[model samples]
Structure formats: structure tokens, C-alpha cells
Target chain A: MGATIGRSIQCGGHRTLWASQGRSRETRQRAEAEGFEEVTALVDLCAQSDVIVSVCPPHAAAQLAEQVAGTGYGGVYVDANAIPPALAGRIGELIVGAGGGYVDGSIIGPPARASGSTRVYLSGTGAASVAELFDAGAADAVVLDGFFTSASALKMVYAAYTKGSAALLLSVLGGARSLRVDEALRLEWAMSIPELPARSDRLLEYSGRKAWRFEGEMRFISETFESAGLPGGFHSAAAEIYRRLGGQADESFPVAHEQTLTDLLAGAEPAPFDPTR
Target chain B: MGATIGRSIQCGGHRTLWASQGRSRETRQRAEAEGFEEVTALVDLCAQSDVIVSVCPPHAAAQLAEQVAGTGYGGVYVDANAIPPALAGRIGELIVGAGGGYVDGSIIGPPARASGSTRVYLSGTGAASVAELFDAGAADAVVLDGFFTSASALKMVYAAYTKGSAALLLSVLGGARSLRVDEALRLEWAMSIPELPARSDRLLEYSGRKAWRFEGEMRFISETFESAGLPGGFHSAAAEIYRRLGGQADESFPVAHEQTLTDLLAGAEPAPFDPTR
Candidate 1:
């Protein structure tokens, strides 16, 4: 996502700078290869760029926002990470307190590598300006007419069925495997509920390599639901399902290391519940 | 199920008697309507019928078997209920100790009201003999080559997904409703996962009136999975979802009292968990 945005900004005739202080060497190389100027010091990057976009795992969203805010940057800050509304609001306060304009952004589809499927939704007063930064036709960045947390809320709810259902399917299949009647259950499904056989296969294909990434997202989603006064047990269990299938290839498409539904249910251990995670 | 078996027995030129000692007036009337001769005493029913089939809720299966065994029933006893294997084994012991031949039977699909789509899987030494009682093509009563608990095990595992997935989807939608994102979530599912839009509708339709019946089945499935060393939280949570839906009209097809997904998540309160239930 970062590389896509960097290439888009370069195509729009704007200088793009990335702060690679604690990032991997591969990430630095990818940013450089995408025509992004690399700056080791956060202060230098903060001074050079007019706008900054933070895209990382949900757990790191708040810490990254704080690091960027601590640099006393007064530019527009866009957070395009999967996070809850309350957390986005808190991050909004962090960035706004440091005299920076805050824009809550969420990436709905896949990364804009070659285009066509991604929509970057933005909210807040700085949203339109931030959307224009990536308006190079590689991706669609739309400005929503709402406050800071609206984009985050949309993302959280959107994933409740998208990635959330994956966990539900995994839990049911895993439960069947544990009971030693998975094959019989599959046969029964084939006879009556014909949608499940194909749905499970599609879920496995789409989510196998991405399970590791979805763990934290599900955790944040659980928190979002619970904080809204709903039961979070499903997604809490879902996070554990993803955690069981830890450390994937970090790619959207399934690779050789990805596990199918049968292999996932058989190979991975059901991790014990830990709400703190 | 009992009605179908009674009809098949009568069609085969055999007499069928039902023990209606503690049954409701409506059930007795239904049995009479279905051509079953009603006996007010268990001993009388046990003496008259060569084969007795026990079909009830999972919670009452063991108690029903005990009651029949107390009458010193020497005939072949078929326990056809959704229950855990351990409970079935215990019931088998109770019947066998009382000099009665015991057959474990699991009814997959709906009640054998019509001819198609229902299977009666029977297991144990007397399974073949019990299968003979209802082999008149009304329903397929197959004798599985295994111990008494095998049939019950199959039923428990099959329902872990069939009914278990219903609970998962309900919990997710319920969570979204509580978070005030249900409409948004539904719209997203419609736009992205076209299958979920139809699947959610089907789940709501099938589970509306039968939520009361599935509560006990899910509980037994949870116990079966937990006994096999799997996490039982999903089914345990699912049981609560059904419990929230409360009692229904006890019909197979959708009627006037049925609740759609929108009505269910909106009208039904999220009941607190009670493991004792």
C-alpha cells in the first residue's frame, strides 16, 4: 500500500519521502525502487513532505501516530490503517494536538499495485486535500462527509463480515475436525447446504496467506464491537483462529506456504484465549 | 420421525404402539392421527411393541431411555436423539442392563414427514433389526457397522457445522447491530460477497422457528467437541444466540411467527450466558 501511494504521488508530480528509521531493509529498497526519497531522520522527512500517510498493522497505528506527532510536524497526516473508531479518534487528538491536520483514511480493497479494485476512503476537514494527493487514477480516494472516525467505523464494520466470516468458517471446520466428523459434515453440507463447500474453498483461497495479518485486525474489530456494547466473543475466537495460522508470506494471493482449510484445521493448534492480545 | 416410522410399520402390515404416559394432549392426538395406537402405561407399550424408538430432545434422551428400561423392556430399543456419544453410551448401558437390545440412531435432516431428504442412521448389534422396522421406503434407515455411540457421534459432528454456522452468522450480525453497523455490513456483504446476502436470508428463514430445537443440539455438540479436546466456545456462544431467539412455533417451514434476520437481531435481546442450561 505504501509503495503504491508513493508511486502515485511521484506520478502526480509531487516529491515523496519515506522515513525508514526502523523499517526492514527490503521495505527501504521497495520504497526506493518505487521512486520515493528515503530519509533516515523523522525530522528530515517531516520537514520535506507536505502530507504523511501511515499504513501499518493495527497494533502499531497509535504508536506510529505518536512518533509522527512527536516530530512537531504541522502537515496533513493521513492514517490509512485498519483500526477502531475510538482509537482513530484518539490518534486524531494526538496529531491535532501537535498542530497537524488529521485525516482518517481506510483502504477498502487490495493495494493499488496495478489499479481497479482499491478505494481509499478519507474523512475530516483535511480529507479532500489528502485525497487529491493520490488522485493519479491508480486508485480512487474518496472524501466522506463525516467526522474523523467515520472512515475507521466503515472499515471496522466492512471487515466484520469479510474477514470475520473467515474466522467463523474456520472455527466450525476446526470444531468438526476436533469431533472427528469433518468429512461426514462436509458430505451433509454437500447434500443440503451446497453453498458451504464452495464458500469454504473460496475463504481458504482468499484468506490462507493473509491469516497472520488478520489476527490483529480481528482483535481490533473485537475491541470495536465490545466498546460499542456488543458481544465480542466471535471475533475474539476469530483472532485466535488467525493466530493459530501465524506468520504467512505477507502476500494477498496464496503461495506454496499457504494452508488450505483441511490442512489449516489439521496442522494448526487451537491457541488458548488471551484477551490482552 | 415417530409418525413416519409408525406409518411405515402400518404400511408393512405391522401394529405400532406409542407410550403416551407423560406426553402432551397434542402429541397424543398427533400420534393417533398418524395411525399410532396409544398406550397410557410404559409397561403396556413395552409389552405390545417389538421395537421402540425414542425420539426427544437431547436433554431428555437419557431420562427417556431410563424410563423405558425401568419397565423391563425386552424388545429392541432405538435411541434416536441428537446427543453426545458418552450420553448415548450411558443410555446403552441402562437399556442393555435391563435385558433390552439397544440401537443408537441419529436422525440427519428434518423429520421424515415426506419421503425424501431424511436419513436414519442406526448403529449397534440390534441396528439391522431396528432398521427392518422402518425399511418400507418412507425413509432410508441404514444400519451402520459400529458401536452404539458411532451414530450419535456422527449426528453431533454433522450439526457442529450445520447448526453451528447459523450461530456464528447470527452472532456476527448481532454484533454488527449492536455496533450500529448492521445496515452498512449488509450492504457491504451484498456488494462484495453475494453469497452472504442469500446465505443470511436462508439462515434466517430456516432457523427462525427452529431456534428452540437447535439450542439443545448445539449444547450437545459443544460437549462432544469439548470432550474430544476442542474449544467449545463457538457452540456454547451459539446456544446463547438460539436461546435469545427463545421458543418458536415448532414448525419446519416458515410461518407467520417467524423472525427474519432483521427482526431477529432487532427484536431478540442478547441473552446472558448460562452454562447450566
Candidate 2:
């Protein structure tokens, strides 16, 4: 997603710089394929760039922000990862406290490989300027007139359904399978919710491939729900669902639906509730 | 729902007998409107009926079954409530142990006011006979070729998503409202999931009215998930969501969406995790 976003910025005629010191070979290849200038050190990348967009897994967003903050380079910092609103706000404070401009951003839809397929929602102080960088590019950049954390809040809530419901459908299918009523449930759904059986099949095919990334995102969403004074258990359970499928992330092809269902059932031991997580 | 189902059975040219001694005035009126013969005592109703169908709140299913068992009514008993498969199995055992033919049944969809909109799934020993009772009636009756508990298991997984996703959407909307990004989130959803904003509104208006009933059903679903060797937290949290809105069950009309949101936010205290519940 980061490489694709960089490509979008480059399409707008801006020079995009990336630090590949600790990134995977695939990450380096993807970034290089997008023609992004690679800097060997984080400090060098920070010093050379006017704007730094952080797009990584939810777990890595804060650490990357801290690393950029440590370099003492005061530039427009865009945190475009999926994290809780409070975490986005804290990251904003970290960046602004270091004399840098902060923009809370979240990427919606898929990677911006085609026009109108994705949106980059920007909020906070430098949002407009960052939006300008994606002008007429593949990713439609929308500047939001709300607090800095609103972008992250929007992302959290948006995925709260799309991904959350996927996890839920998977869990339901798994439960039905465990109870030996999977076929009956499918036939019943066909008469009512006609879309569900196919949807469940698609979730089984695709979700496990990305479950590793989604596990952390679900936790962030759980925290986001808790911070907003709602129960966090939905996404917390979704995280457990994804964690069970996390092993399939490295598979070369989409794991067979039955295999994924077996994996899910094998990991059915309920995790102890931890409020502190 | 019970009265409606009775009406559907009556439409099939069967005499419907209902015990209205402990029922609410509205329930009695509904039953009378359906032309069901009212029996003053449950034992009398049990003694006169060839087959008894129990359709009540999920929490009351067990108690009602036990009461019927105590009557020593050696007739066909159909447990048609929204309950876990295991509970359905237990109820089936109690009925069969008392020298009665047990039919595991579950009504899916809404009250059977019209054909094709609702179905009553039946399994077990007297399932075919129970299905025959609804022949050419408002609710489509289908008998499964599996264990008796398959009917309840199907209902558990089916509602686990339909109602579970509704609770989730409400929570996400409430969370967005709490973060003061409700409008932004709605706008984003409009561009992505066009159905959500109005769906959330409908949920806020309608879900609260039936939340009291659904709260118990959600817990049953949670237990069903656990019994099927899956995490139960999704529906457990959904139960909490419905519990928050349980106050609206008695409203004269649909409560305003904002009031429902406020009600949800006000009851956001996290409940302790109870594995035993």
C-alpha cells in the first residue's frame, strides 16, 4: 500500500523517497518498481524529504513515527496507517511536539493502482498540502474538515464493519461446520441471505492470506471501540479469528476453504480476556 | 411470534390451543385474534393437545420445556425457540424422557404472516409430523435429514450474522458519534458501503424495540458458538449491545435514533468476562 501510494504521489510529479534499510526484499522491490528514490538510512531519508507518509501495518505505525521523530527532521508527517484515533492523536502530538507539521491520514479501499479505486482521507493541519500531492493521481485524496484523529477514526469505523463482518461470517461458518450443520446453514442462507454462502467462501479464500496483517488491525479497532466508550470484544474476538488464520498468510496460494476451516476449528480454544491489551 | 405461528398452524386447518394464564394482555389478545382456543391452565393445554410447540424468548425455553415435561403429557413436543443446539438437545431429552415424541424445531425469518417469507425447520423423531402441521400454511416447513439439533444449530448460525452484524453496525455508528466523526464516517460509508447509513438508522429505530428479546438470543448464540468450539465473544458483545438498548423494548413508538445512540453510549461500561454465563 505504501509503495502504491508513493507511486500515486510520483504520478503527481513529486519525488518520493523511501528508506529500505530494514525493509524486506519484496518491499524494496515493490518500492523500486514504483521508481521511488531509496535512501540507505532513516536519518538520510528524513533529512531529504519534505513530507513523510507512514503506511505500514497498524503495529508498526507508531514505532516508525518515533523513528522519524528521533531524526529531528521537522516536515509534514502523514500517518496513513490503520490505528485507533487516540493512537493517531498521540502520534500527532509526538510529531508536532518535535516541531513538525502533522496530518492524520487513512487509506480506504485497495492499494491505489487504478483511478478512483482508492481514497486517501486527510485531516489536521497539513492535510490540504498533502492532498495536493495526490492531485489527479490514481488515489483520490479527500481533505476532511475535522480533528486530526477523525481520519483514523473514520478508518477504524469503516473497517470495523467490512473486515469485522468478514471475521464474523468466518466464525459463524466455522461454528456451523463444527456443529455439523454447515450444509444445512448454507441451504437456509440460499433461501434467505443468498449472498452469504458465496461471501463466506470468498472470505475463507482471501481473508486468511491477509489475516496476519488484519490481526493487529483488529486489535487497533478493538482499542478504538473501547476508547469511544463501546465494548471492544467484537474486534477482540475478530483478532482471535484472524490470529487463528495467521498461519495461512505465508501460503503460496489461497488455502483451500476446508483447510482454513480446519485451521480455525483447531484453534478454537478461547483466549483469556485481557483488558489491558 | 408464538401467536403468529399458531395462526399459521390454524390456517393449515389445525385446531390451535394456547395457555394464556400467565401471558400478557397483549399476548392474550394476539392469541385470541388468531382464533386460538384459550386454555386457562398449562396442564389443561398440555392434556388436550396432540402436539405442543414452544416458542418463547431463548432464556425461557428451558423452563417452559421443564414445565411441559412435568405435565407428563405423552404427546409430540416441538421445541421451536431460538436456543443453542445443546439446549435444544437437552429439551428434547426432557420431553422424550417423559414419554413424549420430541421434534427439534426452529422458526427462521419473521413471524409467518405470509408464505415464502418464513420457514420452520424441523428434525428428530416427530419432525415429519410437525412439518405436516404447517403444510400449505404461511411458514414454509422443511424437515432436515440430520440430527434433531440441526434445526437450532441452523438458527444459531443464521441469526449470529443478521443480528450480530446489526449490533456491530450500531456500535460502530455509536463509536463514530462519540468521536464526533459520525458525519464523516457516514460520508465515507456512502462512498463505500452505500447501505450502511440507512441500515444503521433502521437498526437504531427497530432493533431497540426487540433488543430485550434479542439479548437473550445473542447469549444463546454465544453459547452455541462456544459449544461448537469457537470463540463466543462476538455474540457476547452483541448481547451487551442489545442489553444497553433493552430499555427501549417498552417504548410506545420507535425511539429517535439520537436517543438510541445516547442510550448506547451511556451504558458503555465494560462488563466482566463471565465464561460461565
Candidate 3:
């Protein structure tokens, strides 16, 4: 995603520099091939670029923000990672205290591997300026008129449905398998909600390999809900489901051909059902 | 439902009788108006009818089956209610011990108010005979080839998604409201999942009035999942959500326009989120 966005910046007639501090050799080669200028130090990249966008794993968002803050580079810092709003607010504080302009941003849809498939939503005072930097790119950069943390909040709740429903379907199908009525339940779904069976298949195709990412993402989403005083048990369970699914390729992900997927989930069961009234 | 099924039985050219032991005056009047023979004594009704179909509330299914079995009713006794398979098996035992032919049945969809909206799914050896009772009716009585309890198993898992997803949306929407991003969350949902905004409102309309029923239904669903060695937390939380909603009308049900719903849910919070790193 970072490479693709950097290419988009270059297409918009701006010089894009990437810090090769801890990146892989393959990524460095790809960045160089994609018209990106790779720099050895984070400070050198910060000093040269007018905007620094952080797009990494959820767990690394804070660490990257802190590293940029330590450099004391007063550039427009856009943290476009999937983290809880409170954590984004904390990162905002970290950047502002270091005399850097902060923009809370979140990317929806997917990576800009193709045109019209992704969007970058930005919030905060510097959001419009940051959006302007990616004008007419592969992804649309839209500025939101809200507090700095609003973009992150939107991402958290939006994912609470997309990935959350996948976990819910997994739980539902597993429970049906355990009860020995999976086919009957699926038939009922077809009669009542015809979209669900296809939707489950779509989740398997798209979210199977991404389950590893969703594990941490759902944990942060759970925290986001808990911070607002709502029950976080659903997404917490979702995180556990994703943890069990891991990062298997889409083709290797278990489908409902037999009882394979449900059997895998059922093996992780804590106990047998209590038959008492 | 009873009236519609009774009319179907009468249309099938059979003597249909109903026991009015504890029924209301209005119900008795409606039973007579719908061509059902209303009997004043339970034993008399049990002795006269060729088959007795038990359709009542979830909590009352056991009691009614016990009452009929105590009368030594040797005819086909069909237990059709929304309950777990274990409870259905228990009711099957109660009827069979008294020399009665037991057929486990479950009704999906609404009551047979008109036509093409309800189905009565039946199982067990006597299911074929019981299905013959509703030869031509507003409701479709389809016999399933399985154990006496398979029909209820289907019902348990099927409702887990239909009503379960409704409760999940309520939690998601109410959480978004608490975080002060309800509109933003709705906008994102509209963009990504076009079905969700209307689906949420549909839940508020249908599930709200029926939440009182869903509270117990979700509890039984939780037990059903737990019996199958799956986690019961989702339906348990769903039961609590419905319990908090408590069967309000749509106008009185809390909406995103206010904070009334989230406040009630937040009251049941266990603990605030720990902000420690």
C-alpha cells in the first residue's frame, strides 16, 4: 500500500522518498523500480519530503509515529493505519508536541493496486493540505471536516461489520455443524436470506489470507468499542476466530465442502455442550 | 397459528378438536369461529382427537407435553415449538413414555396469518403421519428424515443468524452512537454495505417488538451452541441486548437521534477500558 501510494504521489508530480531503515531488500527494490527515492535514515526522508504518511501494521503505528516525532521534522504527518481512535489521538498528541502538523487518516476499500478501488479519508486541520498532495492519483484523497480522531473511529466501526460479520458467519456455521444441521441451516438461509450463502463464500475468498491482519485489527476494534463503554465481546471473539484461521492462502482456506472448516473450528472448542435443562 | 392450522385440518376432512383448559374467552370464541371443536376438558380432548399438536411458548412446551402425557394420550403427539434439540428430545420422551407417537416439529417464519409465509418442519417416525394432518394448508408441513430432534436443531441455528445479527447491529449502532460517530459510521456503512442501513432499521422495526420473545430464544440458542461445544457468548450477549431493549414499539425504541439506547446498554458495562500501554 505504501509503495502504491508513493507511486501515486510521483504521478501527481511530487518527489517521493521512502526511508529504507528496516524494510526488506525486495521492498527496497520494488520502491526504487516504482519511481521512489530510497533514503537510508528516517531523518533524511523527513527533512526532504513535504508530507510523511505512515501506513504499516496496527502494532507499529505508534512506534513509527514516535520515531518520526523524535526526528523533530515539522512536516505534515499522516498516520493512515488501522488503530483505535484513542491511540490515533495519542499519536496526534505525540506529533503536535514535536512541532509537526498531524493528520488522522484511514484508507478504506483496499490498496490502490488499480484505479477506483481505494480511498484515503483524512481528518484534522492539515487534512485538506494532505489531500491536496495526492491530487488525481490512483486513490481519491477526501478531507473530512471533523476532529483529528474521527477518521480512525470511522475505520474501526466500519471494520466491525466487514470483518466482524465474517467471524460471526464462521461461528454460526460451526455451531450448525456441531448441531448436525449445517445443511438444513444453509437451506433456511437460502430461503430467507439468499445473500448470506454467497456472502460467506465471498468472505472465504477475500478474508481468508487476511485473517492474520484481522486478528490484531479486531483486537484494536474491540478496544475502540470498549473505550466508548460498549460490550467488546463480539470483536474479541472475532479476533479469536481470526487467530484460529491464521494466514492461509485463499485457495487453502477451508470451505464448507464437507465438515472440514467446522471440524477445524470445533477442535478448538473448550468443552462439550452441557445437556442439562 | 392454531386457528390457521386447525382450519387446515378441517379442510383436510378430519375431526379437529382443541382443549380450552386455560385459553382466553376471546381465543375460544375465535376457535369456534374458525371451525374448531372447543372441548372443556383436557382428557376428553385428548381422548377424542386422533392427533394432538402442541404449539405454545418456549417456556411452556414442556409443561403442556407433560399435561398431555399424564392423560395417557396414545395418539400422535407433535411437539412444535422454538426450543433446543435437547428440550425437544426431552418432550419426545415425555410423550413416548405414555404410549403416544411423538413427532418433533418446528415452525419457521411467521404464523399462518394468510399464505406462503410459514412452514412447519417435522421429524421422527410419526412425522409423516403428522404432516398428513396439514394435507393442504396455508403453512407447508414438510417432513425431515432424521432423529426426533433434528427439526429443533435447525431452528436453533437458523434463528442464531436471523435474530442474532439483529442484536449485533443494535450493539454496533449503539456503540457508534456512544463514540459520537453514529452518522459517520452510518455513512460508511451506506457506502460499503448498502444493505445495512435498511437492515438496521428493519431490525428496529421487527426485532424490537419481538425482542421479549428473542430474549428467551437467544438464551436457548446459547445453550444449544454450548451443548455443541461452541462458545455461547454471542447469543448470550444478544439475549442481554434484547433484554435491555425489552419489546418496545418502534416509536419508543431508542434510535441514533438520541443517546437513550446506548446509555441503557452502557449501564451494564463490566469495566472501563484500561488505557495502559
List the DockQ of the predictions in order. 0.22, 0.43, 0.38
Residues B101-155, candidate 1: write the lDDT tens digits. 8888888876666666787888878788777777674766766654456678778
Model 1 chain B TM at 0.86
TM for every model, in the order presented, reads: 0.82, 0.94, 0.86
Give the runs in model 2 whose Cα sits over 4 Å from its true position. A269-277, B269-277
Write model 1 residue lDDT over A78-162, tens digit each, in one string. Answer: 8989998778888888988998988888887766765556778788777888888777747678676545666787788778666
| Two-chain DockQ for model 2 | 0.43
Q: So what's the TM-score on candidate 2?
A: 0.94
Each prediction's fraction of true contacts recovered: 0.21, 0.62, 0.39
* Model 3: CA > 4 A from native: A21-33, A41-48, A70-74, A113-116, A247-266, A269-277, B19-33, B40-50, B66-73, B113-116, B247-277
Candidate with maximal TM-score: 2
State the lDDT of candidate 3 residue by residue for A1-277, as single tens digits: 8888777778888888988888889888889889788789998998897789998878789999998999997988899999998888889889989998889989888668766677788887878888887786887787765667777877887888777767878777777766667777777778778888887666555555767788899899888877766667778878877776663544564454343365336455543433222
Cα deviation at B162, candidate 2, in Å, is 0.6
lDDT of each: 0.72, 0.86, 0.77
Decide which is better by lDDT, 1 or 3. Answer: 3
Instruction: Report the Cα lDDT for candidate 2.
Output: 0.86
